[model samples]
Structures are given as C-alpha cells and as structure tokens.
Target chain A: MTVAAEALAGRSARRRVRETVVTHVCLVIGVLIFAFPIYLALIGSTHTSGTIGRGDVPLLPGPDAVANYAQAWGIGGGRFMGVPAGGMLLNSLLMASLIAVGKIAISLTSAYAIAFFRFPGRMVFFWLIFITLMLPVEVRIIPTFQVMVSLGMTNSMAGLVIPLIASATATLLFRQFFLTIPDEYVEAAKIDGAGPVRFFFDVLLPLSRTNIAALFVILFIYGWNQYLWPLLIVNDRSLETIVVGLTKMIGSGDAQNEWNVIMATAVLAMVPPVGVVLLMQRWFVRGLTETEK
Target chain B: MATLTLSGVRKSFGATAVLHGVDLAVRDGEMIVVVGASGCGKSTLLRIVAGLETATAGRVMIGDQDVTALEPADRDVAMVFQNYALYPHMSVFQNMAYGLKIRGLPKPEIIRRVDEAAALLDIGGLLDRKPRQLSGGQRQRVAMGRAIVREPKLFLFDEPLSNLDAKLRVQMRAEIRRLQKRLGVTSLFVTHDQVEAMTLGDRLVVMHAGHAAQIATPMEVWERPADTYVAGFIGSPAMNFLAATLEAGGAAARLADGLVLPFADGSRAGEAGRKLTLGIRPEHLRPQTGGLRVMVELVEPLGAESLLHGRLPDGAEMTVKLAGAVHADGVLEVMPIAEALHVFDGETGRRIEPLG
Candidate 1:
C-alpha cells in the first residue's frame, strides 16, 4: 500500500510539473511578442543609417550606438531644419512637466470645489467640465488655436501646455477620489480651526498624496506624447518637442532619412516617462487599491 | 469651559426640516448627551453647536458670545467624530498638534500641549505612529487627545464611541466621562445608545422626530419621561406601552382587557373616559398570586435574571424581568407596581401628570 501511494504521488507530481512547464512556455511567448518591437528598435538604434537604409533589419545591435545617439542629441538630422535634439528634449521636458503640474493643480481645486462645496449651478458646472472629456484636443484644435492666438500665447510654452491641460480626465479622477474622503475629515478640520483654504492645504492635499503621485505618472506620459498640438502651435524649430521633432526628422517623404538617430531619439524620449512610472510604482499600486474612509 | 445655549435652533434642507426648533441650555463644565434614533436630528443639533451647520433661524451662544453666524474655525470649538477622524497621514503627535499649529501657536507651545495631551491619554509612546498603525481604541484615544490639546470652549462628540466593540465601548465611555469631568470642558455628546447617554452625560436630551422630547437627568428621564416617546426610548427592553382609558377621574387607567391599574399619586388632570397609554418598564412587573393573567410565549435566562415575554388577555405583548429563575408553565400572573406606572394621553402621547 505504501509503494502504491508513492507511485500515485509521483504521477501527480509529474502532472503538476508538466502544467508548470506549459504555463511558463506560454508566458515566455507572450513576453517576447510584446517586447519584439522594442527589441528591434534597440538593435536599429545601434546600427549606422546607411546600413539600416539598405533594408537589412539587423537582429543584433551594431557598434554605431555612440555615434548615432551623439548626432541625434547635438545635431538633428534635417539639412536646413536641423533642430538640435537636445533643445527638443528640453522643450518636451518643460512642456510635459508644466502640463502635469498645471493639470493637477487645476484639477485638484476644481475637484475640491465640486465635491466638497454646495452652491448654485454646482452640478451644471461639473457637467460643463465633464463634457470636455469627450471633446479631445484634436476635435477642437482650430478653436483652441484661435483662442490661444487671441490670448497672445501662440508659439509659446503656454499654448503647448495650457490647451492640453483643459481635459477633464484628471479632474474626474480627483473628484471620484475626493468623494471617497469621509465627511468627518472635513468636519474635523473645521472644528480644528481650519478654514477652507487651510483645510485644502493641510488635510485635503496631504490625504491626496498617493492619488497625486499616480496621476502625475499618467499626466506626464500624456503630456510627453503630445504630437498634434505642438506640431500645430510651434512654428520655430527650437521650440519643437521631441515627439514632433522625430516626425520632422523623416523630412517630408523620400528625403534619405537618418533612421538610426531617430530610433536613438525615440529611446531617449521614452526614458523620462518610464523612469517616472518606475519611481512612482509603489504609490501607484497603493493608490489604485487602497481607499481612505 | 463655557455654557452653551441654543434657542429655537431650526434647520431646513430645502423644504425638508431636519431640526424643528431645538432649544437646549447646557451649564458650564457640564456634559449633555443628545440621544435619539437615526434621522432624529441629534447629530444635526451637535453640528450646529460645533458650527458645522447653520441653523435656519436661531441663535447659538457659547459662553457670552453669540456664535450663530461665525464659521467653525472662529467658533473656538473642537469635535470628535464617530469614525475618530484622525488624519490618516498625520502622526499621533501631529494630529493632536494640528489645530494649534493652524492657529499659529508657537512651536514649543504646540509641542508641549501635544505632549501633555498624549500623556494624559496614555498614548505618549505612540506619538510617532500614524493613525492607521494604531488599534481602534488607540485611534479613539488619539481623537480625544486631539480635542483635549485644543482646549476649545466647547467639545462636540458625534457618537464618538459608536464605532468601538462592546467591551471597548464600555471602557471608553468611562474614560470619556472621567476625562470630561477632570478637564471640566463643556461638552455636547450625541448618540443613539441609551446606555451611553445614561452613563456619560450629566443631563440627557431624548429627541424624537425633530423635537427635543425630553431633557433631564438620566434618572429623571428614565423614571419620569416627559412623553410616551421618551418613555419608550429610554430603557432597556423599552417601556411597555398599553392602550387604556382614564377612569374614576384619572385615578385609574383601565386596559382593554378589563384590568384597571391605579395611580400611585392619586388622581391625574386628565378627563374621565379620555384615551390614555399606560407605560410600565419591564423590570417594574412582579409576579403576584392574584394579578393580571398572561400567557408566557418565551423565556430568556440571563443567569442572575430572566426575562419573561408574554401576552396579556387582550393580546398586548408585555415583558417582565424576574430575579433568578422560576419554574413555571406557559401561563403566569403578574402585576405592575403602582408607583412605577406611567400614564400618557393616548392622542398626543404626552405624559399625564398627577395633580398637585
């Protein structure tokens, strides 16, 4: 009976091992499928432009990583319109950071007012702000550009940042989060001798830290990937964002493109947002799961 | 510590009136508990005292100041909420110190008061820990500590002990009473628990619907409830109410089952044949050889005491608390001790007092 039991145990263990092997094989295939394009981009960024132009998709990285990245960073690829990738990178950073901070600030205050206060037209005003979520920047680009020009903000960082910041996704997220904050906190703060403004800074802001961090990651990525707005507003090459600059590098069809440098710039463009996500990953996970009551 | 006075305090949300003219006068250094069922505006009344809500038309005076129109910050009051709204991000020390800090108290003063309050609450060692890290009782203590450090003119407690478990609630109730007395801070506590109200407050306000049904000492409210509502709400197992009519010029009330209960203090002011309600607490009923006949439906043994739930001849349900155990069949005879009987006008539910 003991031998029979051992044989039964051995058969079940083998079945379990086989199941584990199949699960691991599927996960590996899934990872490779998602990672293939990024892997190809990495290899292409290291090869010379002439080598990539000859239509050979190199499986392994060549030795031109240093030259390609340096050229993309200092001297961009276009002949007359060779906007330095360094300047474009700085512009992207400024726009992205400004938009992220600006949206969070506006959204926090608007969400606070909407969620905590009661006044006339509160819901109507909330609906007004919420309706903007459906009409993205692409749908209202012309009207927004006209308004920006009227405000003397065109071709400036304000135009690039402010128009995109008007979207209500962040505000809705913050309002949903703020609504979950117990009414007791507000009442407690009031009895603690905190006025509205003081309560905002002391209680509301501190309690919103995790949500703010999670939102910063999302907004930063959204701002960094802005293409249409920057391309439309920024007339000067120096003000070009890295995303728009990458498209400009191809130089209007059939102008022998520097694919290696563009690929290196793409890799560089991804670093800041990826770093932000990694840095805020702990807070992001907690913010998504935990609720303050 | 200061006196709190609310005169004709009324609150309305659109057309729905939540508090319909609540008037209370709490003496200096006194703890007054406002007790009621849910939606009875007890919390609303406390919030009005805390300046969290504006009364529709009334005046609130703390000490000598009329603070009806003042903001909560300017009212110089502190409140502890039911959930113990300790800031999740702030440590025990900082949570206690936040109000003083906001008022621009000097750093050393804030630290000293926070330390003092924390020490008083016996949470001195937990000063560095956040609220979420503490146990429920600890968090409740921190909330109390936060209120104590402020030294505000009035302390408003909105069911501060309701969230705790049974054993912890009893412990905290004693602590809160001791602390309030020791500090001598004028306080208004609101709760739906009669036992809490009885134990914690010097005077209890029993509210029903939107009105202050009765406000008196716990013993007075329990023994001489102002109305049938207060009579029913103030005791465990609740005061038993039976439909009856005045007889012999209010000297006696005759139940529908033909059993007549006489008043201890002679005749009352009610008219003859006037409809009335006879209120008798469960514990006031005693077994007698010849008394009202009842059919026992259920028996609950509570070790030292037992509760007998039964139906009278007229089908009115009554519960009697008996000492020790009694071997009995399904039927028994019981009587209401005459002095313990409470009579109310049936139409208005108002208590009918004996004549002077």
Candidate 2:
C-alpha cells in the first residue's frame, strides 16, 4: 500500500485508542465520586469516636471495629433516650416486611376489582383511591396521627406499619399490569367452575408473581427509609425503627457524637435493603422494565 | 349430553340493543354453529348460554334445568375460548385437573380423567409442560382437554381455532369435529367464518343485525336461505343479487334490462308489478347458448374452478363459478339454474316461497 495511506490508517487507530482510554478514565472518576462517601462511612465505623472528632477524615480503618459493632448491637448508643441497634433493626425488619406484604395484598385486590368488575361508581372509586397518589404521608401526617391516637394504636407496632400501608403507586402499578391480562383467562376460569375468590387465588395471583416480586423491592426500601411517621407515632424506645434510632444517636452541638457506633448502625441499616435488591436483582430489573403485556 | 334451548333470548346494553328476541333449540349430541359478522351478537349469545353473560330477557334451558339464573360454575357448561385461555402458571395436567379438584373429586379420579383427556387430545406427553412452553396448536389442544375432562352437560366454543394459521386451523377444525362427534356432547360453536360454520356445525344459525337470519342444516341453509341477508352471508364470493319484478302471474321474473327468467316451481300469488330481488349462488350460474349476457371484468382461478366476475347487462355486478379454467375477456352468456334461483321481496328482504 502507499506510505500516505498507511500513515493515515495508523493515525486513526491511535485516535481510537486514545478515545477508549479517555472514556475509561472518566468512568473510573464517576465511580470514585459515588463510592467515596460510603468508603468514608465504612472507615469511620472502624474507628474510635475520638479519631473522628479530631477533625480530619480517617482514610483508613482503625482498631475499634469489633467493639463499636458490639456496643451498637448490645447497648444503646446515647446515654439518654437510647435504643439498641439490634432490637431496632428487628422492629424495622418487621415493619418493612409487613408494609411491603400489606401494600401488595391491598393493591392487588383493589386493582383487580377496578380492572375486572363492573360496579356502581367504579370510576369514582378508582379516582378516589388514585387521588391518594397526590398526597404522601408528609401531607396527611397530622390527621393520620390524630386517627391513630383515637384508635389507641400509637406507640405500637401496628401504628408503625398499618397507617403506612395504603399505597396508590403500587395500586396503579398493579392496575396497569392487571389490565394486560386477557379477559379470556377469566372466562375460561369461570367456565371451569372457579368462583371469583378461587380465580383470584389460582389464576390471577399466579400471573402476578413477577409484578409482586418487583413491587416488593421498592416497597421494602420505602418502608425501611421511613423516619418521620415512625418518629411521630412511636416515641417508645422499644418500638424505635433503625432509621429513627440512628438519628437519635447524634448528640447536640456541644456534646461529642458517638461517630463509630452511629456509622456502624448506618452500615447495619444498609444491609437489609441492599441484600433484598441484590437477591431479587433479576426479577426487579425485569418487573421494572419488561411487562409481558 | 343434554338438549339445549333458548326461548326469546334478548339483551341490550344501555340504549344499544345487541340481541333482539331470539329462539333456538339444540338437540342432544348436536353441534349448532352460530355464525355472523362482528357485532352481530353471536359471541354474546354463546356467552349467555355459557352463563358468562346474563340475558336481559329470556329463558335458557339445558335439558330439564332452567340455567338462566345460574352462575357459569353451577350451570355445568365448559367453554373453549379463541385464545385458548390456558392458565399461564399451571402445567397442562394441573390445568385439566383444577375443575375436578374444585368440585372436591377424589384425587385418583381427577388424575384418571385428566390422563384420559390428555390421551384423547394426543397431548399426554405435554401434561407436565406449562401453557406458554407449548405451541399455539398444543395450547389449543390443552384447552380442549381441560374442557373435555369437565364432563359438563354442554360445550361452548367461541371461535377457538381462529388464532392458528390456515393449515393448522383446517386440521384443528377436523380434529374438533371428530372429537365432538365421538363425545356426543351438545355444543354451540360461534364463528364469523362461513367455512368454519359450514364444515363444523350440524346446523347453522346465521345472525344479521342482532337477529337470526336463518337456522337450518348447512346444506339447507346453502340451498334455501330464508332471506336475502342469509343468502348473501353464507356463500363464498357471496350470492349475486339483481333487481327485478314479478310478472306472468309470478311464474317468471322480469329483469331490470327487460329480460325474463322463470322460477323453478310454477309460481302463483305475487302481484305482476311487485319489485323483487333475485338471488343466485356463484356455482349455480352456467354458460348457456341463449341466456343473460354479461361483460366480464376479472377472473379468479382456484385450481379446480374459476370465478368470472362481470357486470350483468342490467349494470349489476355478478360472479359465476365455472368448472375448470375459462378465460373471458369481453362478454359471455350465463344463466342461473331455475331450481337454484332464490326470490325475495324487495321491500322487506324476506324470502318469497312458491305456493306449493
């Protein structure tokens, strides 16, 4: 081949390699930017509170990792109004699991009825439920607290979970999914002598498995991250959730915070939600993006 | 198997009337096909008999039991849907056994019945496979097996083979007919395709505008349609209609172009100048030495026979099915066999039978 043509080809190949190198460098920087804070938290959890208060961020692990975790799990973090991380984690787990299951159950039934059955004021009822989508817990906190107070459910586990269970997002999601189910399935089930209840359990419920699994991940995270509602309703230390209890570990401006125990609590709190997402990663991705309908 | 009867079944959704008052009797072990165009309420009528739909006005009886008020479950009828409607989660065996399980049948009995049905449909090996894992025809057989295992009093089929390819549809059609006949189940099959209606049904109910235009055996409906609508709907390439008037004391009809054609039977009662519609199937028209002349427009060959589409001398278009292949470019003389000619009153569209 000609020398000029060979030179041009060589230059283009060099340019392409340079472009690839630049792209990888940029992606590495992006990853570090996101991962740096979590790294700092992990390093902080392994240090003594004194090391954190020295006003320089600890870049490496310290020697107190085992002690900090043990204290966080066994004893309360702060001296006054403190709750153990272990009990609080259990409370959080129960509340989150209950909220997830409750939301899926209610949303599935309500969505099925709205999608399949003909009733008086069906659109009106659907709109009423859908309107709840516009109002999150922050907006209805005062009135909901008042109702919970009157029902005498405050300071109880039921107060922590039940009031947070009616979810319009999950309902709308399931309704969209249920709409994709063909009418022929219902008709075939009816002819096969399945009553409405039997059809719901046998055909409809089984068809909704992937959707349920997908929604569970979102609901679990949502339930785990809840702080304001639980703080308002449950002041009892025994009923404190991990998220709320984590905040209670910080002292006022003058007093030094138990940075090591608090960071350990944060790590522990990350475990369940992260584990759930990882465990159901396949279905979560599928449910969120690929609807068979 | 049981005899089925629908007396004056009527339905309406709000102000839109879907099914007018209708009456039909389905004999024991008979398969009656309800055929019509979309929106003709054929599916609605089948749903009513299946108890999936409630008729606004009528009594439905399966054998001696009045099933108008019963739920589909209590009505003891099984249906095969157009989409097959196999449960997405269950294996074929589980799907077939579910109804029996619901009825609290013994486990062994359920197994035996499901196995029997699977063997009958040639789907025994597919019993453990989910519905989505099977092909369309396999899913259809599974659906049929599910229905067959129920041993219900009546069977309802709502265009079940419509989803398959043409060849598969033809094969499944014959299979379904053979199975239904072997089982001797009273069945009502609904479809919009006239070929399916003709080949599958012992009797055909041709629906038109929410009304039963004709109810008769396939040959009877083809040979002597009760009205112009039925005549036009039941035949492929459709029946040719031409405007004419009764003359010669109803013994003959005078065409719009001033040609006269005799009716098969010696006719008697119509007024001489009454406007009439003459119906002739495509296969009944023949080339004659002296007949109505037509200007040929297009020809469609179907291997064994060729259809010559042309305009009659009166300017009305018609199609003639000629035996073997025939090429026509300009004009041809074609005449309808007198015995195959149909006459209807132009105003009411009702058949005008000869006074025998």
The per-candidate count of clashes, in order, stands at 0, 0
Steric clash pairs (candidate 2): none
C-alpha RMSD for every candidate: 2.4, 2.9
Worst 10 residues of 2 chain B by lDDT: B264-273
Query: How accurate locally, in lDDT, is each candidate?
Result: 0.89, 0.91
Among all windows of 10 consecutive residues in model 1 chain A, the one with the lowest summed lDDT is A76-85
Please identify model 2 stretches exceeding 4 Å from their true place: A1-30, A76-82, A291-293
Q: Poorest 10 consecutive residues of model 2 chain A by lDDT?
A: A75-84
Q: List the residue pairs that clash in candidate 1.
A: none
Candidate 1 lDDT, B191-246, residue by residue in tens: 99999999998999998888999999999999989999999889998888899888
- Distance from true location, Cα of B223 in model 1, Å: 1.5
DockQ of all candidate complexes: 0.71, 0.66
Per-residue CA lDDT of model 1 for A115-195, tens digit only, reads 999999999999999898899888999998899989988888878898888649889999999888898888888878888
Docking quality level of the chain pair in candidate 2: medium
